[model samples]
Target: MEYRKLTESEIVELQNQGCVASNWDSISVHRQFNTAYIRHVNFSGDIKLGIYEKEFTLPGGIKKHSGIKNVTLHNCEIGNNTFISDVNNYIANYKIGDNVFIHNLELMYVDHESSFGNGIEVTVLNETGGREVIIHDKLSASFAYIMSFYRHRPALIHKMQEIVKLYTQQNTSNIGTVGNNVKIINTGTIKNVRIRDYATIESTCHLENGTINSNEYDPVHIGYNVMAKDFIISSGSHVEDGTMLTRCFIGQACQLGHTYSASDSLFFSNCQGENGEACAIFAGPYTVTHHKSTLLISGMYSFMNAGSGSNQSNHMYKLGPIHQGVMERGGKTASDSYILWPAKIGAFSLVMGRHYRNSDTSKMPFSYLIEHDDETVLVPGVNLRSVGTIRDAQKFPKRDKRKDPHKMDQINFNLLSPYTVQKMFQGIEVLNELLSTCGEASVHYTYRGCRIKGSSLRSGLKYYDIAITKFLGNSIISRLSNCPCTSDEEIREYLKPDSSAGLDKWRDLAGLLAPSTEIDKLIEDIESGRLTCIEDINAVFEKLHKDYYSLEWTWAWDKIQEYFNLSPDTITAKDIITIVEKWKEAVVKLDWMIYEDARKEFSLPTHTSFGMDGNKKDQKIDFEQVRGIFEKNAFVEAVLEHIKVKSKLGEDTIERLSKCL
Candidate 1:
């Protein structure tokens, strides 16, 4: 884009069109600049103008030509075919890009040098400090997870924060950027912000010191009274409807609206917040709270949903809001439920009532923490056959709205990965230990500040065994896929792990599931300076996410041997056939359980709400009309189909294994 000094005739024409400049010599115009389009504009300091030969086709088929009208610009470079009009205050020290539209804005400027919200330390989990995540444009959920969760590694934290600092310095600039194809209309007070291509900021209020990392493919939308400071809004996100944010990082495809207020929080991919408040929280992928009275504070969460009036207390009075909690992935709180801080809930668990204890059930996945007569009762391994849990697992992958080709968060949507399955293994040990210590005849047992009924204990054992069999069977079948299982040597060769990467424990690093040993190796690299930069760390996380399945197979093989008590070196087709039988039985049984759970939704009690003006027959008809019959429900049908598929898969595998005879 070449610019030339304004000609004498063009200067006269601009002046005649009600334009004023501090100094005529400081303004430069494009070679084909037309003076007819510049109207009632005041230019100060320096200006580089572009030609206005394009017309924008707005909503309702209105055509408006691109040009400056009734605006003041200072030290700005205007781009080609852009439109600027009705700015209440001047836009200063900004580089406006091509095809951009700026209209009816109050103030858009850069007062001083700024980093555009990069390298801002967000205090997450423990608000008093300690667990601050250094936020930047490239920050990922797993990256933030390690930074906030691994506070014991001072060297690692320092190294990562230093890398962010360098990035912040590189982004520091006196001139703010409004990139190509942007639309800023009816906005107020945007200062020290760097906005990228295709971002639509309409009716937004008070955005300062932020970076809108928008792209053409998946543009960000900030609308209707959004006020944000010290933030980074990632691609394909929305901040609208009077939402207020401070010191936060909103990740890709997330939705925050309906007066939601968030401070010192980090929300990763596909998370949502509406009509609620979040403070000092780490909301990983699919964490959602849509109710008005809900509050998520000082916690680490992923794949969890907060019901209406759900609240967590971080202030223990003595600690001064320092205590934090963990609700591991796939957990949910019933409406009006509460929990005290410093508590740890297990994966796929449901919190159904208020609890005052600092209960820790981290090892018990797929459990129910319900308030039975004001006592915290743990019904373990119940959610394994829950209709809602399976439906949630199925919905997560389908609900992912991220359209960006380069997704910042490496999310794993698998419901039964080694991360949760390993917890099941430990949970089995925990339940058995509790039953043994309390004596099975005692009727009720206590463990980790929660009560377990005798019947629930036995049922938990059954559920965990079924889930384990299903998992182990799936792994062995997948390993033996396409193999000719005719000999012991061939079967053992097929069952052997391709690598030893996943032999040990597994971790859910926010959303990415990988082996503990591998995560430890990466941490060692970071602490020892082998992974010196954020990009290097991110590259490792990305690689771990991509290699998850192969690594998972390695972990599953070891668990199979240990759980089923089989030596891998001498494992034969007969041993595998035995595992398959257990797996087939487990699969059929669990599916039947889930099917029964689904049936409960359409039971007699549920019909009460359906037929308000009719009798039982009308209730049945109305219920079927509104919610469909249970047999034809999409989820029920899917479950039925799934049972058929898995049953066939199991039978096929058994027949193939019998060939060894």
Candidate 2:
């Protein structure tokens, strides 16, 4: 990319083409620069022009040579084969890369030294100022989670902030980069933004101070009427359709469109948000909200689906929208559902209707929070049998759209992991305490600002037992799958914990689910100044995520001894067979419940409103045509298949155990 002096003939040819410059001596051109086609272009300050010899094909099959027309460049370097034309204002203080296209843009400029959205503190979660995460190009959801929420560890927070500041300083430049093969067509204003290779930014309104982390493999798109400021949109993401964002970090393959307005939020991979307003929220992987009336504010969420008209109140009359809530992974809200802030809903739980009570159900995962006559009723562990829960778990891995090999976020998409299983273990103790304190015959028990009925308590205990057995059995079976033996010594060795770390509490730090001990180690490293780089922090999360299964087995081994009352050292084949049978029963019973729930969709009551113009028989016929019979439903059929597969798997494992015995 060496530049040579412009020839006298070339200068004369440029003068003939109406191209003017402040100082002709200060401008340099490529060796093969052709000034014949340049027209009405004004160049100022230091400028370098490359040869425009490449031809481009328009959408309508018209071929045109790459050349500038009716544009103004201010202290810019134009690369070879790049076309810059019809800029209404001026392209100032920028380095346009090779083969880049900038057409019909109102203004594109870099004003002084800029980080291009890096090191901009995003006031997430609390939204006041204590939890300000400095947004960087490599800032994943997990890292942001720690930086925003783990403020109690001030040293770790300071270290993380310093690391981000170092990254920002390293990335600071006066001249912004428009990477090779980029297209900025029909855009309005792009100020201090770094456009990456293969990015298609068409019809964008205004993009200021952001880094579009696009590459050739997975090109990012910022489409019509999109206004983003102080943002870092990662690769494979699409922020289009009039979406407005400020101080946000949008992760890989995420979609934010249809007039979605988000501020001070972190949306991670595969999240689809539309027609909603999100403020100071942490939206993790697969957290989706598609309704305009849905307002998710001052909350932490992951693998969640906010239903239509779902709203959460962050402020009581005393506080000024300062309080926040956490809906753990796989949680869902029914339409028009509401929750007061400072509440914590459990993982895989469902919230229905409006409740003013601030409930904490974090210890009771897979539960339901239903509002009955203005009272919040908790039905614990009922969602373990839900078809939707299983479907959501199965679909997440299949829906991953990130094609980049270097995935920044290490997402563990397991539905039942050490995280939830630990909660279940705690839930069993809590339930037993409740039953002990308030006798078994008590009609209802009150705990954590929610009422649990007698029937619900009994059912919850049963559901938790089934889930715990299933998890422990699944872990043990997986461990012994490849190493089958008849001896109790071999079984004990196989069931022994791989690592002592997983025995402690587990946490879902956004997308990275790991034992709290591992998180503590990361914090300790940061505090000791051993982990300073963002890459180093991300590497730790990746390591923990990769070793999830091994850690999970460790946790399961401890639970098997505690809950099943069987010492691993002397456990026989009969015990393994019994566990496998329990697992099979839990698996099939849950699937059958889901199957029966699916049948409710095609019941007579469901057909009452259908075929309103005809009789009840016509209603049934109409329902059959439109909704189809429940037996023929796709999800129902899948549920049946799941039941059969799990049942056969359990029988096969038990049969193998019987042979060993």
Candidate 3:
């Protein structure tokens, strides 16, 4: 976009059209610029203007000519075919991109050298600022997870912080940018903000020191009284409806609206917050809170759903608001639930009622923490067979709205992964120990500040066994799905792991599930100064995500060796057949349990409140109208189909192995 000095005749014409410039010599215009399109505009400092050659077709098929009108600009470059109209307070020190439309804006400017919200320390997880993650455009939840939680590794933290500082220095500039094809209308007081391509800012109240990382494929939208400061909003996200954010990083495809307020929080991909409040929290992928009364404070959560009035206390009487909590992936809170800080809830667990006890259930996944008579009663391994649990797992992948090819958060939606399965294994051992020490007839046993009833303990063991069997079976079946070998040597060779990276403990890094060894290797690289760029760290996480399945096979094979007591060197076809039989039983049994649980929704007890002032027949009809019959439900039918498929799979495998016998 080359510019030439304004002609003497054009300057006279601009003056006749009520346009004035502080210094005529400092003004430059595009070669094809016409004086007819510049009207009643005041320019100060150095100004470069482009030709207004096109018209913008706005909503409702209204076409508006592209030109500068009734605007005051300072040290600005207006790109080709862009329109700036009715800027009340002036736009200063900005590069306006091509095809942009800015109308009726109160002010948009960069007052000083600014990084546009990069390298801003968001004090998340703890309000008193012990765990502060520097927010940046390239920051992933997994990356932030390490920075905020892995503080024990000072070298790694220092290296990461240095990298972010470098990024900030590289991006620091005196001029902000409004990218191509963007629309900013009826906005108020935008300062030191970098708006990216195709972003839509409509009726926004205020935006200060932020970076909107928008793109053509996944454009961000800020609408209706949004007040954001010190933020980085990623692609495909929408912040609207009187939402207020300070020191926050809104990740890709997230939605924050309906007067939601968040301070010092980090929201990862696919998170949604409506009519709620968040303070100093780490909201990982799929963390949702829709109700107005719910408040998430000083906690770390992922794949979580907070019901209405769900709240947590971050401060005890003796200290400041410094306490924090961790709710592992797939955790949920029932309506009006409350949890005290410094508590750790397990994965796939549900919390109900008010509980002040600082309970820890990190090793017990798929459980329920219920407040009963001022005591926290933990029912472990119950969510494994829950209909809602399976539904949520199925919906997350389907509901992912991120259209960007480069997704920052590497999310794993698996309900039964090595991370959770390992916990289940530990949960079974803990339950067994409880039974041994307290005696089977004791009826109620205590663990981790919660009471576990006798029936729940036995059920927990059964549930863990079923899930473990199902996971191991899935791995073996996938390995042998296309196996052409029939001999024992070929079978052992087929069973051998392709990679040994996942043989030990696994971790759920916010939402990404991978082996701890892989994560440690990444941290080691960072500590050793091998990975200095944030992109390099993200690339490592992506590589680990891509190689998840092959790595999972290594861990599964190790578990197989431990459980079956057969090494890969001596494993036989008969042993595999036995394992398949047990897998068949496990799969069918769990599916049956889930199916029965789904049936409970249609039971008479569940319909007690339905069909008011009507008979039993009306109650049945009313329940069926809203909840539908259990047999015809989509999830129930899928479960039934899964049972059939697994039964046939087991039969086929057993038949194939019988030929070796």
Candidate 4:
């Protein structure tokens, strides 16, 4: 693609075709540039034009030749086979890439040097601005998690900030770029933005200082009435339908539409926001809300769902929105629920009704926080038997929409990880202490301003023991999967841990469930300037994610020894058989519980409106047709099959151990 000064005769032909140039000598064109396609276009200020010979067949079978018509360009370069038409204002100070189709654009320009949304400090979590995450195009949920939550380590924070600053400085430029194969149609007022390859911007309004990180693998889409400022929307994400954003970072494969608005927020992979509002929040992977009046403000959430009319108060009316809350992964809120800020919710917990009390359930996972008589009542370890919880865990990995090869977020959808299991361990200890101190005969107990009934406390203890038995059983069984252990020594050798990495406490660092010891090592590297590059930091996270299973086995083995009162050196096949028997019982009991819970969906009370104009038999037929019988339900069958499989596994292991005896 060579550019040459236009000939005198070619200039005359362009002039005859309603085209004008401020300086004829300043304009340059490709050697194969045709004057026949240039019509009614105004050009100025050092322009370069490419060969336009391709035909674009648009929707509705409209064939359009790639050419420039009815447009005004200033200090711009047009790429090969690109089409530009019907610009109301101008396209200036930008380079339009190859094969782009631009029509009905009002304004597109670069006024000054910009980093295109990189290094934009998004005030997440706390609105008064104590916690701010520097957003860049390659920002991952784990990266933002450490920066927003680990502000106490000033040296680490300073090193991380400086690394991001250097990257942003390298990206600063005066000339904006519209990459190859982009389509910008009926758009208005794009300023100081970088449009990457294969992006589609249709009918969008007012984008400023942003990066649309579109690629061939996963292109981004910005549809009608979308207005954003100081943002970085990653690949495969769609932000459209009257959504408004300011100072936000939208990670890969997220959806924001239906008039949803957010300010100073960071939404990571697979998160959805529709018909709601968010302010100063950190929404990690799988945080979703699809109802109106659901306001998420000054909160940190991951793998969470907000019900309709769910709200949280960030201000006590005394301070200026300085409070924040954390709902650990897999948390949910019932419709019309409310919580005051500075509260911490446990993993896989449910909240129902309004609660004025700031009860922190951080150490009690899988609990129900209910408002009864204006007091919070905690029901612990109930979600383990819930069919809905199992379904949610199964659906997250299946529903992942990210198609990018280089994914920014590393998400783990495992429900029974060390992070939650550690919480359950603490829960059992806490419940036992309460029983010993409050006396078993007492009817109710209170902790952290939340009431716990005596029956609930007993049930929690039983449930935790069963679940821990199930987990440890599963771990030991998996460890000795194919080992031919004929004697006690062989059994002990087979059950040895692969690594010692997971002996420390585990933390759910956004989506990755990893040991705190590993995270501390990463922090040390950052603070000591060994991991200065952002890519290097991300690589460490990826390695940690890859080694999760090896690390998990070590953690599970330690817990097994502690909970089952056995050492690897002294443990025998007989002891393993005992654990397996407990494991089999726990697995069978939980499956039956979940199976009974699923049956509730098909109960008679649920069939009230099924047969409105019919009798009892007709009602039965309608219910069976609509909801299906509980026996044939997919989840119910899976649960029953799990019981069969686990029971057989236990019996087989016991028989092998009997042979050893």
Candidate 5:
């Protein structure tokens, strides 16, 4: 982009075209710059202009050539064919790229050296100083997790901070950039923000000190009345509808709209937040909150849906707003549900009512925490039979909205992964301990500050056993799917663990579900400084996510040996058939339970409010018309289909194993 001095006649032509300049000698233009259609523009300091040879199509059918009108520039460089018009304040210290459009903006300027929101400390989770994560352009949820939660490892934190600081230093500049083909129209007070290629910013209120990591393939959108500061929004994200954010790192394809407000929060890929407020929360992939009264504050969550009026109290009277809670992946809250902080809810569980007892249900995945008589009642492992849980697991992979090739978050959507299975195993132990300590005939047992009734305890044990059998059977079938059982030796070989990494324990680090040993290896790498780069850490998470099934089989095999008291080397066809039979029973029974649960939705009590203005026969007709017959419902049909499919799968596998006899 070479520039030469403007000719005297060209300057006089620009003056005749109503282009005023404080110093004509300070202005320069490209070789083919023409003064056609340039009007009422004030140029100050050093300025460079490129040729405006292209025409732009307006919102309607009209086309107009690219030209500047009613604008002021200070030390700016305008690119070729760009349209700058009606800038009320000025465009200063900026480099506008080719084909960029800036129209009806109040002010767009770069005052001093800025990293554009990189290296801004976001105090996440614990709203205190110790857990601050310095957000950078490439900061992923996993990296922020380590920086915020693993603060005990000072050296690792220091190294990560140093890397971010280095990246920020490399990105620091005084000249703001508006990349090619960007549209910044009806914007107000855009200061020190770097607009990437093909970004569409329309009717934005304010954007300051941020990086819009947009590109041509997946352009970012900042629509009407959005206000942000000290943020780094990734590619393919849409922040609009009066959303306000500060010190936030918005991940790819996430949506924040409808007057949503967030501060000191990190929302990862595919998260949708509307009409709610988030503060100091680590919102991982698929964390959605759509209610106006929902306030997600001082918590860690992923794959979660906060129901309407869902709230959590982070501070007791004594803790100084320091307490935080965790609702592991796939957890959901019923409407108006609340939980006091310093509590842990299990994965895929449902929280129905307000609970202030600080219950910890981590070891009891897929359960329900209900409030009864001012006490929290735990119904453990019952959600394994829930149709909603199965639907959520099935839909997450299909609902992934991330279009960027380089995905920052590694999401694992497995419903029966080792992360939940291990919790089931431990839940069995805890339930048994409760039953043993308090007589099995006792009406209720208390554990973890939550009450469990005797009937619920018994049913919970049954449900957990069924789930364990199902998971083990699923793993065994998958393992032997390719390996033909020509002989007993091949069966023995197939039964052995693929890797030692999954034998002991497993964890869900937000959404990355893997064996604890793999997580340990990552932590050890960080401790040894071998995995210093954030990209390297993210690569480890991706690898673990990729090898999930293999590692899961390793964990399941060991658990099978422990649960069934059988050596894999000596197991006969009869034993395998017995396991398959158990799997069939478990699968059908759970599906039937879900079917019955679905039936409850269409019961007489449920239909009472539905047929409000009808007689008895008309009520029945109206209910059938509006809600449809229970048997013909979509979810009920799906449940019936699931039962048939799973039962057939079990029987087919058993028939395959019966040949080994």
Candidate 6:
């Protein structure tokens, strides 16, 4: 594209068409520029324009030529076939892309050199500044996970920071970009922001120092009075309806709307926020808050849901909002629930009522933390039988909205992986120690700022045993599902783990669950100058995710040997058969427990409100119409079917092993 001054006849044609310029020599155009398309435009200071020969169709089917009209541009290069109209202030220092439509915007410019939103230090998790994550355009949830939690490994942190700093330096620029096929309509001041291809901005109030990493495959939408500063919104996300954010990072496929206000926070893939407020929090994958009164402050959460009016206190009046808390994945809070800071809640646990005491229940997964008469009561292993927990596990994978091939977060949606099972094992040991020391006749036992009743403690032990049995059995069965083994030696060979990488402690890094030992090895490589880039770190995470099941068997094999007190060298066909029998019993028994739990919803007491104005027969009819009979319920039928399928699977495996004897 070449630009040149207009001829004498072309200058008269431009003057007749209401085009004015400070100096005609300063205003240049394409060699084939059409004078017919130039109308009602004011240009100043080194402006260059591309040839526009096409027409743009408006949303309501009105068509207009693709040219600059009713606009004033300064120090800009307009692309071919772009339409810019009604810019009240001006668009300066911008390189507008081809096929773009910019209309009714107040001002769009770049003030000086900027990195968009990269390298902005967001003080997350701990507001006082011990945990600060520098956000970048390519910042994945797993990368941020290691930076925020791996504070003990200072070398690893410094290495990651250096890699990110290199990325920021490469992206620093003077002129902003509005990529091809972008639409900006009814927008207000956009300053030092970088817009990517195929992104849509409609009715936005203001955006400053941000990067919208949108593309044709996964376009981002910013709409309707939304205001953001120093933020990075990733692909396939929607931030709309008066939502205000400052110093935040919104990851892929996320949704934030309904005037939700957040500051110094990081929200990862598939998270949702509406009508709530967040400050200095790390919201990992699938975190959702839908109510206006919910305030999540200074906490780490993943696979979490906050009910209406759910709140947390991060300051104790002595410290200046320095207190922090951790709620492990799959945690939920009831309406109006509150938790004081410095508390650690376990995975898949539910919190109900207000708990002022700083309780730590990380060793007791699948439990309930309830408030009874101003005291925090812990009921361990109750959520294992909850229908809601099962539903959550089933729906998480289905709700994933990321359509891009390169997903930002590697989420693991397993309900009974080694991450939670390890906690359950510790919980069983703790409960047994309490029962032995306090005597079985004691009414209540206290541990870690909460009280557990004798009956509840006994039941918790039973639940933990059932879950552990199910997990180990699932692992072994899956490993040998299609093995061609007819002898005891062949069966033992099939049970041998493929690798030893997962034989130790495991961790859930936001959503990607893997062995902690492997993560440490990767960190060591980084500090040793072996793995030096962000891509290298993410590739290691991808590899760990790819080999999850192979590694899972190694850990499960070791646990099986320890739990049953039998080694592979001496174990026979009879021992394998016995484990299969135990597994069948555990699976069927747990399914029966869940079935009975669901039946409580249809109990006789639950029909009290349904029969307020009816006789006995009418009451039965009304209840059947609304709630339906428990035997015919969908969830009940699924539970019964699951029991049958699992029982048959276990029995068939045992029968096959009998031949080896």
Local distance difference test values of all predictions, in order: 0.93, 0.89, 0.94, 0.92, 0.89, 0.91
Pairs of residues clashing in candidate 1: none
TM accuracy, model 4:
0.98
Between candidates 1 and 3, the one scoring higher on lDDT is 3
Q: Please write out the lDDT profile of model 2 over residues 131-233, one tens digit for every residue.
A: 8889999988889899988888888888888889999999999999989989899999999999898899999999999999999888999999999999999
- Give the per-residue lDDT of model 4 (tens digit) for 1-661: 6899999999999999999999988899999889888899999998999999999999999998999999999999999999999999999989889999999999999998999999899999998897899999889999999999998998889999999999999989998999999999999999999999999999999999999999999999999999999999999999989999999999999999999999999999999999999999999999999998899999999999999999999988996798999999999999999999889998999999988888888878988999999999999888888998989999999999999999898888988889989999999989999999999999999988689999999998888888889888888888887877788888788778777888869998889889999999999999999998889999989999999988999999999889889987798888888999999999999889999999999888998998889999999999899888889999899889989999999898788776667
Please give, for residues 574-660, the per-residue lDDT of candidate 6 as tens digits. 888888889999999989889998989888888887766879888888999999989999989999999999999998888888888
lDDT per residue (tens digit) for residues 1-661 in model 3: 7889998999999999999999989999899889888999998999999999899998899999999999999999999999999999999999999999999999999998999999999999888887999999899999999999999998888999999999999999999999999999999999999999999999999999999999999999999999999999999999999999999999999999999999999999999999999999999999999999999999999999999999999998787998999999999999999999889999999999998989999999999999999999999999999989989999999999999988999999999999999999899889999988989998899997899889999989989999999999888888987776477788888888887799789999998899999999999999998888999999999999999999999999999889778888888889888899999999999889889989888778999889998999999999899999888988889999999988999999888877677
lDDT of 5: 0.89
Tens digits of lDDT, candidate 5, 387-446: 788889988999988777888888888888888888998999999998889888899999
- lDDT over C-alpha atoms for residue 463 of model 1: 93
Give me the runs in candidate 1 sitting further than 4 Å from their true place.
none
Instruction: Tally clashing residue pairs in candidate 6.
Output: 0
Q: Which stretches of candidate 3 lie over 4 Å from their true place?
A: 608-615
Residue 69 error for model 6, in Å? 1.7
Roughly what TM-score does model 1 have, to 2 decimal places?
A: 0.98
> Which is the better candidate, 1 or 6, if ranked by TM-score?
1
Each candidate's TM vs. the true structure? Answer: 0.98, 0.97, 0.98, 0.98, 0.95, 0.95
Which pairs, if any, clash in model 6? Answer: none
Q: Candidate 5: TM-score? A: 0.95
Please provide, for model 1 over 95-193, each residue's C-alpha lDDT reduced to its tens digit, 9 standing for 90 to 100. 999999998999999988999999898999988988999899999999899999888888888878888898889899999999999999999999999
Screening candidate 4 with a backbone cut-off below 3 angstroms (N, C-alpha, C), the clashing residue pairs are none
How much is the lDDT of residue 225 in candidate 2?
98
Candidate 2: stretches off by over 4 Å = none
